[model samples]
Target: QQQVKQSPQSLIVQKGGISIINCAYENTAFDYFPWYQQFPGKGPALLIAIRPDVSEKKEGRFTISFNKSAKQFSLHIMDSQPGDSATYFCAASYSTSGSRLTFGEGTQLTVNP
Candidate 1:
């Protein structure tokens, strides 16, 4: 898909809790799926990624569940911590297109201690 749209715009999760967010896209041609985490004044870093070839992917406490038929995906942050507070973005692109991603509107997550 070309554009990924995310919801809520922000989230507040308690420490040791789980945070969930959703996203949908418009294009099915996209193959690479990546979630990026960014703090204030910092560039987004790739947190985790999965391809349409896979149903899910996880990295440490971060996980991404993708649904190809639905053209949707989600980011799950487990055991939320204050240090996990940041802005998260869901992104998708294709290697055939040189990995240029169309990012979501972004969700600001704050984990309370």
Candidate 2:
């Protein structure tokens, strides 16, 4: 079974709008939640991450909201811009789970100018 699941196989947003992507995990052992952004012909880069200890984490226009009890998390892009257009993925892992990560299927995002 897929440990992590994400919604909205694709998304489109206008500039300066809000783009939200949600994720849910079945493994309670997952303690680390991270979001990655990838562009064509490039590898995914870690955009933001959160630990189970925090309810939310924000960096610039990127934010991660985690719900430990619900085993869910989401990424919210505020003031979305064309530069932010990319494929976003949500991942979950634990210290004991080795270096591998359980990733969501990914959401393709398009930010229109």
Candidate 3:
């Protein structure tokens, strides 16, 4: 129940379009959900996150929709731009477990100009 499954291994979106990525988890014990965006040769950086208490959270053009009951969540990027292209990952972990995170396989997004 510690696995996080992500889909659409790759995605291509035109500039100004919206990019969507989905993820699901099996662990109900998980209380912290965070999304990370990584560029080539760089470590993953925290983008946005949500707790089970919040059904949705948005930061600028990035939004995260979470369904605690379904054990699923998704990330949406509005008005995607070429500069936004990167590999994104969804992760889950409990705060008590230190900084260790259980991550999804990852989704590569390419925004075309």
- The lowest-lDDT stretch of 10 consecutive residues in candidate 3 is 91-100
Per residue, candidate 3 scores C-alpha lDDT tens digits across 44-111 of: 99999999999999999999999988999999999999999999999999877885899999999999
lDDT of 2 at 23: 99
TM-score: model 2 vs. ground truth:
0.98
lDDT of each: 0.90, 0.95, 0.95
Q: 8-101 in candidate 1: lDDT tens per residue?
A: 6999999999999899988888988888899999999989888898888888888889888899999998999999999999988987888888
Could you report the Cα RMSD, in angstroms, for every candidate shown? 1.5, 0.6, 1.2
Give the C-alpha lDDT of model 2. 0.95
Best candidate, TM-score-wise? 2
Two-way TM-score contest, 1 vs 3, winner: 3
lDDT of candidate model 1 versus the reference: 0.90
List the candidates' TM-scores in order: 0.94, 0.98, 0.96
Segments of candidate 3 deviating more than 4 angstroms: none
Question: Scored by Cα lDDT, where does model 3 land?
Answer: 0.95
Deviation in Å, model 1, residue 88 alpha carbon: 0.3
RMSD of 2: 0.6
